[model samples]
Target: MSKFKKDGKKNTPAVSTASLPDIVFMLLFFFMVTTVMREVDLKIKLSQPDATEIEKLEDRSLVDYVYIGEPTNTALYGTLPKIQLDDAFATVEDIQDYVIEKRADRPEAVHGAIIVSLKVDEETKMGIVTDVKQELREVQALKISYSTREKVNKKKF
Candidate 1:
């Protein structure tokens, strides 16, 4: 029994990190799958007009939005109707090019089906909207949709 005296240097089991990477990667994948990225930060104010007759699009992927309204920073942009493509302010003349480029970005198979949804603010004039339509027509992007909110029923309760 004296020969089996306790040794000062005793080996201790180390913690296993074999599944650490797997757990970390799983977390990363989960975040990647769950995260929803914002398309753009609107520089202009947008309040959709109320509509009595409006239909939702079947496929939203094929749709591109064109925001039309006065700039939120009226001091910088002045109080005038402006067109926003993606995130930047664009002019009426720039619409044709914007449409062309949008078409090129998408697959050719669905170019004809791609819809340009005009999100015009209620305060915005129809002239700007008409101009946008004209540009879309020039590019042959005929499939158009107007973004509007459902009219709330006014009930006296």
Candidate 2:
């Protein structure tokens, strides 16, 4: 006796495309709220050195990145100081202090392991690299790594 049933036509299921946006927005909001934003506190300029031997990193969780570069010398004869990771920290203590403080607050943050990924210019001297490594060693940074880019041009040839 219903108006829809009297005609003998099947009742069509209600399709919803309207709720799609709401669902998507809810997911977006969830991700936005729950995701941790990594803070990049240092702006470093570095030119990667070329290397024939490349090694894959087995452990990445213990790594921290540091960049080294020579400051611009306006005078042609001016002596340029070799800038390294520790030197950078001396200039800007905020990032290093934050990490150290965080480690103190959470003992598991560092977990008795430290690795520094050093990014340096190709023109940087070996002595400079050694000095940087030594400085980090003094700070009890047990692990050190040099960052390098893989050569891709060989594949084209």
Candidate 3:
């Protein structure tokens, strides 16, 4: 008959899982702290039209932004280059030539692809928008996008 004694005898297996929660929490905190967030800055004040469908811009590499606004009537405005709307309208040919030059300069990643993001003021007339679109079309820039803000609380199905 063998006698069982409680002296210098171990019955449980030894495995170290004590620090697992701490390690997991540390990794989670590291990822949360190092994450990068994308932010879009508005160059002009405009009341964006609401839309039920949201179209995400897929190609980020081949994109250029244009800001259109009237010059302010103040001393500070004098320091900035005055954008003569009349003259700007006449420079349609020059603008098209510049776009072609810029398109050639773009890297292969965005080669043969160009997207223009037009930011216009809320008070901007439809005729101006049409004119800008036509100019872009003449440059053979078929991929055009109008800037607009997304509405909050969009219902998802």
The best candidate by TM-score is 1
Listed in order, each prediction's TM-score against the native is: 0.73, 0.49, 0.53
Model 1, clash count?
A: 0
Give the per-residue lDDT digits (tens) of candidate 3, residues 75-118: 54442222122123223345566567768878856755688776
Flag the better candidate by lDDT, 1 or 2.
Answer: 1
Tens digits of per-residue lDDT for model 1, 1-157: 8578766687666999999999999999999999867667888889999987999988877888899998999999998989999989999898888888888988899888999999988999899899899888888989999999999988749
Note the Cα lDDT for every prediction shown.
Answer: 0.89, 0.59, 0.60
**Candidate 1, residue 92: CA error in Å?**
1.0
Model 1, global lDDT: 0.89
| Backbone clashes under 3 angstroms, per model | 0, 0, 0
Q: Cα RMSDs of all predictions?
A: 7.7, 9.3, 10.5
Give the per-residue lDDT of model 2 (tens digit) for 11-32. Answer: 6668979999999999999999
Output the worst ten-in-a-row residue range by lDDT, candidate 3: 81-90
